[model samples]
Target: MATKVKRARKANFSDRECVKLLDIVDANIGKLTNNNNTLRANAGKKAVWKMAAQELSAMSLVQRDEEDCRKKWRVSSLIGPTVTL
Candidate 1:
């Protein structure tokens, strides 16, 4: 049997702190994907790659917005929210 370590909530990271995340997402999307699948075609691969890159960038923006909203809420003294791990 193995022991488990308690996980703590991640402190909200700001936009500037999320630079590496976009790079990692871009570099890893196809790395974990099965490109041989039929939903993706050979000629369309480049376009798909570009779209994935854009999507990851958009996700970074979304994360920043979400963190900002959460921080604003906390600053306003909102509570009764239980963060689940």
Candidate 2:
């Protein structure tokens, strides 16, 4: 009898591959930071911006309405945080 090991299914990505892929993407997308922590932090921010517009567009009912997205993406609440920057 042969013993078999079960592996979990992933979204076609691996930890080792993820790190290398991140490194490459980060290098191409932005300047490298002085430290690993700073590099990672900045990379996270970049990832958010990269996916947000695309995500909003996809999730939105009005696919052709970029203006609707710009409005919807904002914090419409008066007491909420404003886009000062």
TM-score of each: 0.26, 0.28
Q: Give the TM-score of candidate 2.
A: 0.28
Q: Which portions of model 2 show Cα errors greater than 4 Å?
A: 1-37, 61-85
- Our model 1 lands, by Cα RMSD against the true structure, at 13.5
TM-score of 1: 0.26
> Which sections of candidate 1 miss by over 4 Å?
1-9, 35-85
**Local distance difference test values of all predictions, in order:** 0.44, 0.41
lDDT of 1 by residue, 9-31 (tens): 54454443334333443465564
lDDT of 2 at 77: 33
Tens-place lDDT per residue, model 2, 1-85, is 9999899532322333334333443454443232446767767645544454444445443232333332333423334423332
